[model samples]
Target: MKNLLVSLADLPAFEEIIDVRTPLEFADDHIPGAINAPVLSNEERVIVGTLYKQDPFAATKLGAGLVAKNIGAHLASTFKDKPQNWRPLIYCWRGGKRSGSMATWLNLIGWKAWQLEGGYKAYRGQVLQLLETLPAASRFIVLAGHTGCGKTRLLHALAQNGAQTLDLEGLARHRGSVLGSFPATSQPSQKSFDSQLTRQLARFDPARPVFVEAESKRVGQIQLPASLMLAIRAADCILVQARFEDRIRFLCDDYASLFDYPANFKTRLSRLVETHGKVVLAHWNGLIDEGKKAELFAELISKHYDPAYKRSSQSNYLRLSDARPLLIDPSGDLNACARQLIVDFAA
Candidate 1:
């Protein structure tokens, strides 16, 4: 039993990883790549907790029975096909009885199962710590550009072509602007975002530069890691230049869903009232009502986004003055551009 425990570093040694916390706990967060085989249902957990406060002995008896029943259900379903030589790592919130009971049951049934030390809580601590240190040690290549220059598209292209790229906007599910929210998606909680960022960082090769877009402290409501933001500001930069007309077209296509729901689009535009003033807001809203998406996008870039980019890029990105210009074709051949960028930076 003493040898049946592993730390985070020992993760890759296991053939399978199981999260035995309640469903709600697993939904909140869990170890990356771990499968949920909860030892108690959400309601069962609540019931046991309430009973525990009143009678510890009764709670233990009830919890043990519940855990046994759940584990048996998992065996007859979730684990029924497992081979006898299966090696699994199991965890809960704190390597508590939930995980222990599961591990014990599996071991008794002749499967090799180890418990994760200090469970998800300990793993989360390491994730937070790594978020602080990893970005500081990384070399980032910041992609700087005005709105609708296909920075995100280029990021995807670079990724497909095998460049080490981090799409912060994709992770946050927001585009980093007042009107940046995805049409029907929501951003992850901060804790979940940290887990995602940390997972991406773990996959990076330190010897190569990571390609990321120039962003403010926040991407919509998601705050980037301070160290990463600092690293991006100080790192080498590439200015992605696109024709104004092409940009308007690109934004229209990229944000087509918002235009599909004009009322939603106008509501999003209203968020900029305080920043761009009512006169500008009213004009933008009028464009939405008039169904002039191209014209609306054009005005937005020239009036709002371009000016903001000029002001912020000059101040926020320390190396923008010396940034190398990557001219994307008017046809928007991002794959070709990505290939060139790979040779330029990731090489």
Candidate 2:
């Protein structure tokens, strides 16, 4: 009997499996429960690719020999101690040679091993299809406000407070602004972003409202899936308002590290100026050049950010006044605010 590919929905029935893709590929994205047992290490795959380009026939023979030797060693070391009933699911890039060879070897050794029909590529296609369709299935509750109003912070708080929430910028590893990219963190590839979103949405109850921060179609280098953008537009809106000075202080604190690099700081500010215009931009630019970050932040609020909020407020019916002095400061206590909002809304 030949091994067959199985759907993720059917994964619960499978007891053991080995992924035959490279570690980097597996780390970037994979089925939730699959474990890595790569048939080709990253370096070895590079070598094979170079060989294939240089001499296809020689490369094919060498690659096959190397793969067979590796599979033999893997079976001896890992499967030798397994019970006779042990079964393994194997998959590679597209359910091609790598996974096929492994499955064939395992089956010949008296173990039932299967290959995913289309491999990881198929699973990724499923995720992309789901994302393309999710807007119609899910309801959104948008949290909108000026910069540093802590909308992202509030999303986390709401999640803790028992309200369903999706942190789009968080998943994107971006803050959704010109200075959004932090040096220490990196955003996932667009393919991986879809996978992560699909995984996250699977846990949410569609009937309940999911709170998500308002964002443009693009978040840093990644774009929001169209279906998700539609859901965001359809959902009710909540605007968080804060005093200009408070917003300035919040932004300064939120991006304190970026100020250390003046050249990069000027570039980010220049981009914002380009978006907003020159004369008005000059005012903030001068402040940055003078090391008046707090003043510049306050000016950005009064000049650019506040007007944008007013326009959006006019367009949406749902608005929440977050400008009121936090009795307990929701900036640090997001969970408390989320819980309170849930209870208040639930009531």
Give the top-scoring candidate (TM-score): 1
Q: In candidate 1, which residue ranges exceed 4 Å CA deviation?
A: 1-3
Structure candidate 2, residue pairs in collision = 161-339
| Worst lDDT 10-window in candidate 2 | 319-328
Candidate 1 lDDT by residue in tens digits, 262-311: 88888888877888898888888888878899999998998889888877
Q: Each prediction's TM-score against the native? A: 0.91, 0.82
Write model 2 residue lDDT over 1-347, tens digit each, in one string.
46666765665677776788888988888876788877778988888989999999988888898888788878778667978788878888888899998998888888778777788888888898888876566667777767787776677778766788888888899987777886679898888788888878877777777778888788999988877876776666766656656677778888887767777777877876656788776776677668887887777777767777677654543333432233224345667667776665441
Return the lDDT, model 2, position 296.
Answer: 75
Error of 1 at 270 (Å): 2.7
Q: lDDT per prediction?
A: 0.89, 0.76
lDDT of 1 at 271: 77
